[model samples]
Structures are given as C-alpha cells and as structure tokens.
Target: MSMNKEGRPTAAGAVTAIRTAALLPDEPLLFEIGDREHSGVDLPEVEIGEDRLGGFGRRTSLDLAGLTEPEAMRHYVRLSRLNMSIDAGMYPLGSCTMKHNPRLNERMARLPGFADVHPLQPVSTVQGALAVMQQLSDWLMTLTNTAAVALSPKAGAHGELLGMMAIKAAQEARGEGHRRVVLVPESAHGTNPATAAFLGYSVRSIDARADGTVDVEAVKAALGPDVAGIMLTNPNTCGLFEPQVIEIADAVHAAGGFFYCDGANFNAIMGVVRPGDLGIDAMHINLHKTFSTPHGGGGPGAGPVVLSEALAPFAPLPFLRRNGDGLELVEHVEGEALGRITAFHGQMGMYVRALTYMLSHGGDGLAQAAKDAVLNANYIKARLEGTFSAPFGGQPCMHEVLFDDSFLEGTGVTTLDFAKALIDEGFHPMTMYFPLVVHGAMLIEPTESESLQTLDRFCDVMLELASAARAGDAERFTAAPHAAPRRRLDETRAARQPVLKWEEAEGRAEAAE
Candidate 1:
C-alpha cells in the first residue's frame, strides 16, 4: 500500500484488514460486476412496465462501485478500525465536550416509542414523545431558570442565532429596530459575532480585562442607542467565569439592549449558575456539550434555546404543548413565524439521548457533574502550571484550562507542533489557536466523566511533551502522530487549496493505475 502526498493511506496494493476477508471480494466497478445474462436476485415479472415520465432520459449503462454484500461489510469493518472516537479513550478538545456517550442513553434512544415516531403522526399518537419534550423542557427551565425553551434550533451555532433572533424580535417589537450593533468579547467563541452578523447587525469587538473576564468598562463604552446587545460567553472561552457577568448584563439592559449569553460553556456552570439569574435575556444550551450527547464531525446534535420572559413570546415555533387529553405541537402556520430554522421538531434521537442523560443524572447530580468538571479543569491547571504557561496566572478555572505558548519561548515548539505530538501518544490534541485573544491558545477541557487516574496519565504526557520541547528537540513536535493511522499534515496548505473530493484526484489515480 502507498500513502498520498497528504499522508492519507491508500489501498492500492495491500488488502484491508478484516477477520472474514476470505468471504469477501473487493469491488470492481460496473463492467466487471454486472452482466446482461446474470442476476443476483430474481423478481416477479411485472404485468406492465410503468413509465413514470416520457423517455427524456434512460440509462445507457450502469456505473456502480460493485462489491458483494460481504465484501462491503468487511471493507467497512476495516475502515472502522482506522477511526478514533470518544469510545476509544479520552478526547480533550476544549469548547467541544467530547465526553462519553453512555450505552444507556443509546438504549433509550433506540426504543420504538422514540425511534419509530413520524412527524406527520396525529397528536394523540405521539403523546409519549411530547411528554419527553415536556420533561426535558422542565429540566432545562429549572436548570437555567428561564421562562420558556425553544427546542428547534439545531446546534450550538444555530441556537446562538435563535437566541439572537428572539432578542432582535423583542427589540423590534419595542420600536428599537434601529439597534443594529452587537458587542462581542475578544475572547468569545467565533460563533458569537457570526450570529449577530448573519442577522444583519454590525458586530463590534469588546475587550477582556487582564484577568480574562470581559471588561465591563469596554462593554459600557460600546453600548449606545444603536447597540442591539452583547454576545458574551460566560465561563468565557478562557475557561474562567466572568465574575462581572451580572454587572455586564445590567449594563446592557440599562443601555436598552437585551443580553444574549453564549451558553456553549454551560457545561461548566450547568447546575451551579443560571443564565437567567445572571440577568441574561436569552441563551442557548448545547445539549451535546452540557447534557453529554456526542457531537462533532457534522453532528446529530441539539441546541435548545432558553428565553427570559421578554424574549419567550418571540421564540420560534413547532414547540411541544400538552392539552387536556392530547398533546399538541404548537407549529407556526404558513406566513407566520420570524423564521423556521429547522423542519419538523428538530433531531429526535439527540433529544432522546440528552433527556435520557438528564434523567439518569437528576438536577443535583447534574450540578455535581458541573462542579466535578470545574474541579478537573483546575486539577489540570494546578498540575501543569510549572510545566506550561497558563495565561491567566492563578485562579480556579471553569470547565477548561487555557494556556499560552509563551512557555515554549526558547523551546522553538509551537502549539501546533505540541498538539501533533499528542496524537502520537494515542491521545487527541487539545483545542489550539482559539479564543483569539490569547496568543497560541491551548484549551484543555477534561469533562467530569474522566477519573483522576486518566487525568494523571494525560498530565504525564503533557509534562513529557513540555520537557521534550525545553530539551530543544523541535523535530519531535514537528513530525508527530507517527503511531496513529496518519501523521502531521500541512494544515495551512490544506486549508488554502483543499482537495475537497476524491473525484478531483481520480485522474491522477487513474493514470497511475
């Protein structure tokens, strides 16, 4: 076998490893597999061949990637071995809570009641699903201390947009439609300003104090009659709680603008702090992050937005409601609604899994879960302080710890290089070059699910990497992930001139073949 220039493995020569390879044969497309005289399965002859359309087009030839069923199965099994998942081991991607997706949650999601329900089913037929929504809603309301929940926004970014839309709607309703500027912190998630911009509002950057919290003075100066609101990530991206969150919210409210909280970091303060209580007008809870549902790689995710009383009336529709005898879904009719973000009640499977997780861990358990999450992050920070450079000197971190690349000053290793090395150690790299306020930011979020032993092992690897960097072995960091299926990539070139599809490279492959 050979590897592409980008280091993607090729299956040109060697067979893919699979236990039952003897039962399977590799695919040889179209002309090699199908014959005019042979068939794999026989079908009863039709009395009349139906023509769905006048013959504007008809198949002249069949082009298929042909393989026997067993071949296909084996091929997939071999491919699965090359992948890494949360099930494999610890995934320390900060901001992204790639924690365990317990089998119990999967089991409940697969139950026929939820798995088999159709969107067009009558209201009476799906009472159980509606009840689940209501139950989830109750938990969200109690957890965030919000007046209403909009269970339609699809993911974290989508939820951010939804919350902003509600804020916009409430503002417009109050004759403040000219409020067109949004203040986003320098350390906020990238999605915060993107959400505002998508809704046609001008985005203004807010500054962070030396302590890593949003500067209340900077926010105050940014507020005016034309300002719509502020998109703040409390337990801000640096993984430090915004001690001035209430004062910031009050500033926004005093300036006649709604406060929109980016609740992506809700995993850190889930049970401990309520966005509503902090005077947030609206916020979105990432179900995958806070409730422990699996996300990333183009997800099966849910980001339900929680609304304060002012914005609740303007929330998007297709929400669940219970009547006297039957459960009814309150969907906006045609020509209604500010907008319909997603169709037909969002992702039901994610809803089931998130609610299952919430139920298994009751309110108090969820609270303790958040506490443990903060504790784990602090543990990492405390243990690695001597080895790495933590930007915000010495305060207890929230759900994640942020370190700058300054510690590697004379070491000659960049954050990217260090992260690539982690892959070689059979561990996923922490989030790097994010929360742009920090130079070469390395954010590590060890969700509460990890045990102390696991944390210690991760710390050991990190310490070793730091020591190696200090030892001036720049080569070690540059060419990393050697033990994994792939190695370090030219990420800059990959991003700039991406080979988006395999078809684009097929001509070169065909020439070689």
Candidate 2:
C-alpha cells in the first residue's frame, strides 16, 4: 500500500480499491424501477357525485405506475445518501451561507400550531402565529435599528426588488420620478443588477479598488440627478468589508437618491453592525443566511426588508401591525405605500425556523457566531495563503476567504478541474469564478459550524492537491473526481444547449437514432 503525504494510508486510495473490488450499482430512474403490475396498496373505488365534480370529472383511467413499499423506500433512501448537505459535512460556499441547520429550529417549526395553520385562517383563530411573526419582525427591526420591515419578500433577490420598489415609491412621492439609474458595485451579488434592471432602472457598474472594496471616489463619479440608488453588498462578494460604505451611502443620499443594501452577506455582521447606522435607507435581511433557515434548492426562504424612517411609510402592503387586542394585516395600499407583493404572508415555515435560530442564539451568542465565522475563514486563509493566491491579500476578511487561481498556473489544472478534484477529497468545492472581478476566483466560506479539527483535515487535503499540481502531476488534477458517481462533464456545452426536460432528451435520442 502506497503511503500518502502524511506517511499514512490515503482514504482516496482505499476508496479506489473498494471501487475496483465491487463496483457500486448505478441508481436507476424512478420510472426504471417502477413496475406496471406492482401495487403497494389496494383501495376500494369511490363514486364521485356530480355535484362534487361539476362536470369536470375525468372518464378515462389515470396513467399511474406502482412499486412495492420496500422498493419505494429504498429508491429514495439511496438518493438521499448521494446528496451533500450541511448535515453531512462542511459546506464552504461563499456568498451563499450554507451553515448547519439546527435540529432545535426544525423541531420548533414542526410544532402543530405553526406548521398546520392555513394562510386563509381567521386572524382571531391564529393569534399565536401572528404573535410569532410580529415578535420576529420586532427582533429584525431591533437588530438592524430600522424603523419598519416588509416581511413579504420570498427570497434574497425578491427582497431586493421589494426594497427597490419601496425606494421608487418614496422617490415618486417626493416628485423625484426622473431618477432612473441604479449604481451597483462590480463586486455586488449577481442578483443586485438583475433586480435593479427588473424594476426598469438602468444599472451602472461601480469599480472596486485594488483591495477588493468599492472606492468612494468611484461612487462620487457615478452620482447624478438621474441616479435612483445604489445596491451594495457589505463584507462584499470578495469577502472584504467596504470600509468606505458610510461615505458611499452619504454620497448617494446627497445625490437625491436612496441606498439599497444587499443583505446576502449579513451572516458575517449580524449583531456586529447595523446597516442603518451606516446611512442605509433600505436593506434586506436574508433569513435563510443570517438566521439559519434551510437554504438553496429553490428554497422556502424569507428575506424581510428593513427600511429606515425615510422609506418606512412606503413599505409594501400586507404588513402586520398591532391592533387593540391582537395583530392585524394591512392588505391594501394605504397612504404613500407600495402595493402588496405576494398573495399571502411570506414563508411562514421559514419564519418559524429563523425565529427559532435567533431566540436560541440570543444577543451575545449571535455576536459570537459572527466572530467565529470570521475567525474560521481567516484561519483557512492563513493556512493556505502560501499555497494559493488571494486577490485581496493582507486584509482581514469578514466571513469568507477569496482566492484567485494564479498559483495553479502552468499546472494544466483549470478552476473547474480543481473543483471537480475536491469531490475525491470528500468535500464540496468552494464557489468558483464568481464575483467576476477577479480572475478564476475561488470563494470559500467555512461557517462557524465547523470545528478546528474538521478545518485542519480540509486544509490538509487542499495542501496535498496544491503540492501535487506544483510537482507536475497533471493527471491528479485533470482526471479528477475518480470516486464520484458521475464524471467530469462538458459544462460549457451543457450551459449553451441544456436539455431542460426528459422529453427533450427523448427527442434528441430519437433524432440520433
């Protein structure tokens, strides 16, 4: 048995040997495993009344397949085992904070009163639910030092649009309808520009300085009467905080414009700094990221936008307010308000999970969590600095570390290749080629959930990979992810010509035949 760099048997080598010994079975599709004749259950047919159907009833038998109970269970169980979740191991995705989801939060959300209540239920009947939402709103407003919050936005991008709409409404109320441009930093989240453009504002890009933070001088140059506002990400996509944020916000306000802070990276500053104090007019707080709700997979997310006193009155409709006896929802557009955004109140299940996280962490614990997240990221950066090249070196990052692929030069290992190799190391790859400002960016956010021992193991694997690349072992990087269920794919082609549905694939196969 050949020894690894640590003079011990490598787990990768062992895994390869196991694969060679007994190849794992490929997980077939659900349709492939399903049988036409198999039925896990038998139910007596019930005749539908004409009054119940109202002439819309189907006459033909439904086309449905069946599987045994054991088969159904096994199919899903195997699929679940293939997924890489926060519960499984460390998720180092930057910008997208994939921190551990506490079981306590899950338990609290599963409570019958919170989970089973319908949106159309009477306010009097669901008084406890309304109280929970109101308390959560109070916590958000208090933490951000903002005047009011619109909790109807569904996700981060959705929240961005909501805040912008409020800003636009406030501006129009002041007769500043000529403001039609939005300033976005080059390092802002991808959704910032999209959200602004979606709201009919022309987006202008603001350049970042060499240190990876937005320059106040650049903001000054972009300021004009036509400027609507600026969408900025603090502790930005580069993982560095914009020290000149206050000056930027002030300049925008002076230019007869508003400020929209993208709260995607709020996980790093919650309980540390409030955006309102930095002159922010409106900012969205991503409950999924900062408050530790289930994130990604087109999630049930909550991104409540906290507005300053200047913009609070223009908040979206369908907001909660205190009545004489209990809570009340304002569903219609009132004095200078933007209209409702959603059919119902925002994601209730996500709100419950987020509130549980906040209450469990409290004030001091939440602050400590932010500190720990920054510490963990800096630890990773310090460990791998000599082996990798950080775009913005010699600066203390807020929560995540940003690296460029300069060290991988002449190694024949592209960013995609290196990322794929990480699968063999039993870790999910960090966000790659993002922020778009740096060349081949690798953004890693090892949230506070991971312990030092786990961090060290991850670092060790990364170092080994870097060393192999430097020593001219091209195959180690190029022919990567040897142990993954799937091999390297032509990502470029997949993006350009995607088969969006199974029927599309069938059509292509028929054409090929």
- Measured against the true structure, the TM-scores of the candidates, in listed sequence, are 0.89, 0.90
User: Any residue pairs clashing in model 1, and if so which?
Assistant: none
Candidate 1 accuracy as lDDT:
0.82
Question: What lDDT score goes with residue 455 in model 1?
Answer: 97
Residue-wise C-alpha lDDT for candidate 2, range 72-148, written one tens digit per residue: 67767776776778888888988888888898988998899998999999888888888888989988988888999
**Judged by lDDT, which candidate is best?**
2
- Candidate 1: list runs displaced more than 4 Å: 1-53, 60-62, 297-299, 333-339, 504-513
> Candidate 2 regions off by >4 Å?
1-25, 35-65, 68-70, 297-299, 333-336, 504-513
Error of 2 at 59 (Å): 6.7
What does candidate 2 score on TM?
0.90
lDDT of 1 by residue, 126-197 (tens): 899998888888889899999999887889899998899888888888888999999999888998988899
Q: What is residue 444's positional error in candidate 1, in angstroms?
A: 0.2
